[model samples]
Target: MTMHNMKLKLTKVVAIVLLIVSHSVTANTGQPNILWLVIEDMSPLLPMYGDSTISTPNISQLANEGVVYNNAFSTSGVCAPSRAALATGLYPNSFGANNMRTSSNTAETGLPKYEAVPPVNTKMLSQLMREAGYYTTNNYKTDYQFKAPKTAWDENGIFAHWRNKPSNKPFFSIFNFTTTHESGLFEPYGIRKLEQRHYFSSDEKKIALLPNDHRIKTNEETTPVHIDKATRFPVPPYLPDTPTVQNDLWKVYNNLAETDKQIGAIVSALKNDGLLENTIIVFYSDHGGPMPRQKRLIYDSGLKVPLIIRFPKGYKAGTIDERLVSFVDFAPTTLAMAGISIPEYMHGHSFLDTSNERQYIYAAADRFDGFTDTIRAIRDNCYKYIRNYRPNEPYYLPVAYREKIPSMRELLRLQKDDALNKAQGQWFRKEKDDHELFNVCNDPHELSNLAYIENYKTKREEMGDALELWLADIKDDPLMKERQLIDKLWNGKTSQPTTEAPKIAVQNGKVTITSETKGAFISYRMKNDETSPHWQIYQKELPIKQGILEAIAHRPGYIESAPISLAIDAD
Candidate 1:
């Protein structure tokens, strides 16, 4: 056989092994079963991507045994919008998910006035998958638009039954693992920086896993003492290589290893349960690894993610597809895998079609809440264009972000002192970068701004126009009814500079403040701050339905709110 044929055969061989492992049939007979093993805060440091020291054996093994995607990207940097875009397969420009906080119980306050509620007038992947005949379930750790596709899942991940896995048709089970979530434990940073702990050995790792040892330090003036800081990590190119930063990155590496172990358990469970076959598994994180500027910002570090798919025997494997695919394309792609027709409302096209042109990928970030900044970007094969809606805001705000890592505070101090070098200082000094562009091929770190570059002007404008056209066609004006309230409740602070208006909220549930102009105003049309203009706004009494309210308040404004189920009766 020719070399090309040999390569194809080898790929198919790998696919066959997984098929055998999952007990799946080769053909597309009964629609491919969907299984998404999503890991939290992980980057593509897998062995397949050439990272040898990462302790991700199970994941690494999967990479070697399946297909790897080097160009898969998420829609937003933060968890909620990223997962929201993935679920809806629409850009944040279309789906308005400002940021979701761990304790976002402002039901009485309102939604973001400028942000769109997710599952925004579109069919979800799971909903489409169900019509195509698949049982969908989520295990744990969901960071998407909270109530999008309200009834998409047949079961929650923390509660799915494999035995009920429906022998007749296929199954789409999603397990979003959060073992690598940023727990306030990495190394500290600051004037008196800490040193990296060389703990490669298993025993050393155990001993080094102490809270004080990994303290991430900040300034005595601005930093708090009560903050936890043990998982110090290595500072990125933008920051100085202080001891605390080194320790912080080291902890992140350890977290990656720990997350890998958890994934192995889930895979082993699938194998042990005799449901390995007949399932097509796709492994990816919602976005990049959980690092500063990596999680909630709009750079490639935050948007780009690693995707690996393992299919059982009848197809190909051990292949590499380097097409520029975004989370927007995920829904249709998934529906295609489930043998369903793509919906017209979705702006995304399926990447499953090998002939699909992967010319560009689009991503955007917004001041999702009162916590973050507003930014949007578009990327083609070689260039990326960014438009910061709020240029006066600081890159890092007083979200739970500052509360999570200790070193972060120290870095901020250096930023003020101008001690950070050129690269690291850019984010600090960038108090007014309204429009920027970067030649991604030359500047993968996205440190340089090509927006002002004379030669790339045409290219930048073209991409910008494309982004605008896409948004316009989708009726994504960033203001509908519920979306407007969410924006005010979230981004009301910064957007004020442009709108020059006073933002009002619904307090004590009585006043309906109408503005003389179009700005942030609250109108309690619905009792529950409902979005529908037609719905009546009447607060009769608290419902009898209730759940065990475990007053688990968060540090505020970082993560998506944890869903609280109203119990039938009060405790």
Candidate 2:
């Protein structure tokens, strides 16, 4: 036997002596099933939020049946960074995952493909659910600024569902609707790739159509159901109210109506399965709207989103929650609702836990697509303060991805001709204020800057000092260039290394495993005659059973080790 094998044997010998204490290990088995219906690139534009631009009866129904959160915000204005905070229950900047995205689509930008190196012992929220014996599924986007671990899900594809798990097992499933994504604002709306079209039948399509919409060109013969074109929308002061911009508004609301239909389908499925009463449903958007100055900025139009949580049997039905909540609170909140202990390493506190209700929520903006800028924001219930680290950089970065939208193109054309009105011309300013303070409660459009007002100087200084303290506490070095940050993540190496494989030893009726890599979290699955195959977070040595055992090891940001398996008999 090799030296590694010898070490494994010794570990196994020690484990068998303590095997009697392992049989009682189990998690909270009676927790209710959880469901998250996540939509992308949307704001609170429904009837519940006082926006009459569109009527979302399905979402409105959920709002009537659940608790609606009016002050929910994303840490970042963009999706990938917000998702990283949601997945790990930690601030993205705390672990170098704060950039818009770390890999893929970086060739033109000349940035290396690197993953955000979080702490070694960190595990994704799905893996935590799996360890607690809950069936987990995501249908499925894993843009967490790092590659997701193999042990994170039992099913992670378009067809992944709660029904795939064994009967009576509690489940945590996430369904992401791309119909409301920013890409919906691109031209040729009928040809734009939408998630709803993938599953809708021709009959369902006809039911979703609106009368006389601009999305359909003069060329197409077929018309599907969509939102009404005659509905007049209240345009924000930052954009023009021209025919072109109004057309984009129509498209946005039309896409939202389609998103509501998709949400209804998932709720219907739960009811059909007779699981509606036993499941806790959550509905929310990933971030804010998808327009110029909204999708990637630190303004409330970019970071604020709609959040609704319906407990089993509508425990808090028809109530509006006015407390401030951030994306960082999501992971710990999920764990708290499921009866799992929240880890101390998490930066967020559970609103359900009631120990640490927050008085403020913080947000930040960094590099986006091909351009880079650094801005941090702090918000109370009534006021918002923003500090620009690079004050000389223009507020508009000319991002290639955002310019694809029709309204953005219109703004650029109007700017070139000097035909834009005062409100429409705010975004094209040559320079930006270094510090900005706004009473968002009074100025919903955030048009007026109160930073330099003599009467508000004390308030401005207080918010600025609070922001500085937050940055120091989170250990975020926004001044560090992106390239240097990448080097730090990779430890000055050209590439990251994969985690070392674990060594497993099976002796007598117990199995013990250890990895050569320190701080690697070990997860294993054992097949018994009664239960389906599912990964479990290994706490102690596992007792041998009648079926098979498989194990893998991983650390955050490092590639997972190859799974090792063993067969055991009843003897």
Per-candidate TM equals: 0.69, 0.88
lDDT of 2: 0.79
Q: Report model 1's TM-score to 2 decimal places.
A: 0.69
Candidate 1: misplaced stretches above 4 Å?
A: 1-23, 26-29, 101-121, 148-150, 184-235, 478-571
**Residue 469 in model 1: shift from native, Å?**
1.8
lDDT for every model? 0.58, 0.79
In candidate 2, what are the lDDT values of residues 1-571, reduced to their tens digit? 7999757744543343223112211134556788999999988888898887777888998899889999999999899999999999988988888788777558756987778877767878988888887889888778999888767888787667787876756899998888778888788765554434325242231122122243455233553446667778778888888888898888788788878887888787777677777777889988899977788887999999999987756577899988899999999888766667667688887776333458778988887877888889999998999998888778888888888899999999988999988777877778889999999999876878999999999999999999889889888887898888888877787877677887878777678888887667777776554464556667678776767777888876877889987777758
lDDT of 1 at 37: 82
> Evaluated with TM-score, which candidate comes out highest?
2
Q: Model 1, range 1-571, lDDT digits (tens) per residue?
A: 7999757744544443333434464233456667898876666766777665444788876776677888888877767777767777666556445444422534532432233444323555776665555766666445565443223555554445333555675678777655455552443432222121212232221112112233344554543333234544334587678876665666566556655765676666666555566667789987776666567777888888889987765345788888888888877777666656666667677666565667777776655344645666788877888877678876665555444575676677787787888887676664857788988888978998978878988988898898777668755553244446445335555331221122222334322223222322111222233233221111132233232211111111212223222213333
